[model samples]
Target: MRYTSEDVGLLIKTTQYRHHRGLDASLAATGISLVQWSALREIERNPGASMHRLAELSFNSDQAFGTLTARLLRVGLIERFQGPGRVTHHRLTPRGTELLREGRKRVMKVLVLSFASLDEKERDMLGTLLAKLLT
Candidate 1:
């Protein structure tokens, strides 16, 4: 049977779904969803990102991101402060940083196992192809 572009697309989507499920399972002990982890990582990297900016970065609506932030705040994982323009700036708390560190350890294990079948060159080629697709 000949494979078409649609076949490749479906495979890519299925791979993504599987990866997401694996990551969700890995993160279950931490009590955070993939979306929450992504927001935390973004805030950790950005230091003082605004809610609007983070919402944009996370591809979430303002209200949805707001709810996510509220959950983070309630869990003692992050703090929000007043910024210049009256926008709230988010920063990871010490607890948040620890959670991220531990979460990354778990995620790295899953990633390493997931890519174990790929040698270095194959990994590089796959990475390049994925980057090209993104661009």
Candidate 2:
């Protein structure tokens, strides 16, 4: 049967839910929410990144981004300092780095399980197709 718009919407929702769930499971013992984990990861990858930039990078709103950053700050996983344009910049602390290291290990385990069904060729094809769609 051909998929309808409803089918597509449901598929998207389901996929997103599963994605979050996997990340959540991975972060369970790491003391960070999925959003926080994502925020930290983004900041780590882009050193001296601002909250506005992080929001844009994560496709989250400014408010939502602030919430994530606040959580990380409370946990001492991130620090906010002054930067160009007087913007507040975020950087991971040593503890934050350690947490990220632990969190990534867990995330990788979850990812391996999630993609276990896909063989190497299929995985490559999926990655290529996803890149095309993203661009």
Candidate 3:
């Protein structure tokens, strides 16, 4: 079997999907989907950011994020405020904060297992290479 850059790209995408699945399953005990937790994380990291900004940072479309925000708001996991020019901004509620903290622990465990095949040095190299590629 021959390996090419296209194969490498496909493998990268596949690995990411599997990693997301692992994280999602691990986080199920916390009662939040991966997407929801991701949204909460972005809101926590960028407090007072507009929904559009949050959606962009969370990698969702504006309309999809609008629906997500509505769900979050309804559940009291996040609160929205009117920013400048009537733009809606988001922040995590106490519940959201706790969930985020718990979710991070679960995610870390999944991430460690996901890369269990790699030694520390290989993991470091992979991280560096991926960062370089991303940048």
TM-score of each candidate?
Answer: 0.90, 0.87, 0.93
Give me candidate 3's TM-score against the actual structure.
0.93
Candidate 3 Cα errors over 4 Å, as ranges: none
RMSD of 3: 1.5
Q: lDDT tens digits, residues 2-119, model 1?
A: 9799998998999888878898899889888778887888898886777788888877898999999999999999998888887778898999998888888888888889889999
lDDT of 2 by residue, 36-81 (tens): 7788889989887767888988779999999888878887999988
Rank ordering of all candidates by TM-score, starting from the highest = 3, 1, 2
Which stretches of candidate 2 lie above 4 Å from their native place? 1-12
Clashes of 3: 0
Clashes of each: 0, 0, 0
lDDT of each: 0.87, 0.85, 0.92
Residue 61, model 2: lDDT of 97
Question: Model 1 residue 97 lDDT?
Answer: 90
Q: Which candidate is the best by TM-score?
A: 3
Collision pairs in model 3: none
lDDT, candidate 2, equals 0.85
Q: Per-residue CA lDDT of candidate 3, range 1-135, in tens?
A: 897999989999999999889999999999999999999999989877777888999999999999998999999999878888877788889999999999999999999888999999999999999999989
